[model samples]
Target: MPDYEPIVGRYLTIEVAGEACRIHVEEAGDGIPLVCLHTAGSDARQYRHLMCDPAITDHYRVIAFDMPWHGKSNPPVGWRDREYSLTTELYKDTIMAFCRAMELRHPVIMGCSMGGRVVLHLALEQADRFRAVIALEGADRLEPYYELDWLHRPDIHGGEVCAAIVSAQVAPQSPDEYRWETLWSYMQGGPGIFKGDLYFYWYDGHFDDRSPLIDTDKCPVYLLSGEYDSSCTPERTAATASRIAGAKATVMEGIGHFPMSENPALFRTYILPVLDEIRGAG
Candidate 1:
């Protein structure tokens, strides 16, 4: 018999912002819903390890989806008519729509990087809709570290440039195989998609003033940042956690921006306790 993984992949058609979008989703395990969001320029594949791990699946159903325009998810109709720029409203609406469409009642929502930042918004606006929120490598607002124009410039190879740029964000201690695997996802992103995602990451997702408003009593927020992540530094995550009452933040030693993808095994050490806490609370 051929070796097989328990994970399943499917496509779901949903409407967002008056346009139809076909989203690619992968899921595994069975129990409380654990909805995961991937990083900017990447897709649900980032959560492959989590979905496949029996330790987690035995207690939680892990569901990860590629936002339209990334991975196997196709962009909405007439995407060519306008530039693809992810805004705060669009990101939040897409997530909410997906949750409601799937009938995921009070699922535990977790996100990394761009996904990480949006969980803050979700906690602030839709706290009652989720049991808890987990953010990895997220911050209130990020200082622009790279030129967005370079990501989609006519002269640059978008794939190569993107992969190279994010390469440094991976920790040096991560296994070579997984580190390259993480970078490979960046290389495969559609032209301008990575840059478009950053539009929300760096500009539209500002929470410096808004994070303090999230009431942890209603919706708990747990933040984990990899020490090596220069983009969303550990300091920034701690500061954001500090502002939110009852929020918890921890720095994962020897990890980097793409914790789940770059080093899933190590990431597990930090995440398992959080999962246990959520399960205990539930």
Candidate 2:
């Protein structure tokens, strides 16, 4: 069982592109800057344990935010835009905007799942702004799995599935369960948010050309996966790491798609070391 500690932090609303978003920011330690980004449908609290870990916080200023339309953040007026408000090109732009609003310097980004995709997007768009990136369970391709078609499956009863998922999300049994459920609840946003994310998940063509997004010599990158992760294979992630000039990859021993949530101790063990190495090099 993973040790759990719910984060008790203050909420700060920052203006980004004229819109105010309520973000959960915790100031921990003081050395290199570390920004933790959660998977889609989850809030910044997903990194609660990591943020509290002395191994990590003792050496970095950690900050995380709930993507718009998720957690306590307000959604954009144009929430139905083709790009997903929570995790997309537009969201990545907002990330930079948010960082600027906070006056944060170049930070090492650690993003999980959809958050990883956002980090990758930023790395491609502005490599200099980020010193390094740690991607967990994130994919470079939109349609990573061919046969499942997670986005659209007329035969699987989408509404029913989403409803059940939503209910489970809202009715968590414990703190840990609440963390997991909170994530699912975010996924069950209004039709516009959900549909918008679905569209991008299935048809986004931005990742077709990968070279431009990955830095050949500047940014240091690392990819982490769970041994049993079906969403992203170690081989695929390794190949992605191979493409980026100074990137490395690894898989957590006996875990699945959500290593941070499922096996956090192991997740921290492997990830903290890499962060230390990067900070030392810096």
Best by TM-score: 1
The deviation in Å at residue 19 for candidate 1 is 0.9
Please write out the lDDT profile of model 2 over residues 98-217, one tens digit for every residue: 677667888988887666666676677778998888788666764533332332356755434543443332212224653454445444544344444444444552353673457735
TM-score of each: 0.99, 0.77
lDDT of each: 0.94, 0.63
Residue by residue across 76-168, what tens digits does model 1's lDDT show?
A: 888888899999999999999899878898899999999999999999999999999999998988899768999998899998999999999
Which stretch of 10 consecutive residues in model 2 shows the poorest summed lDDT?
A: 165-174
Clashing pairs in 1: none
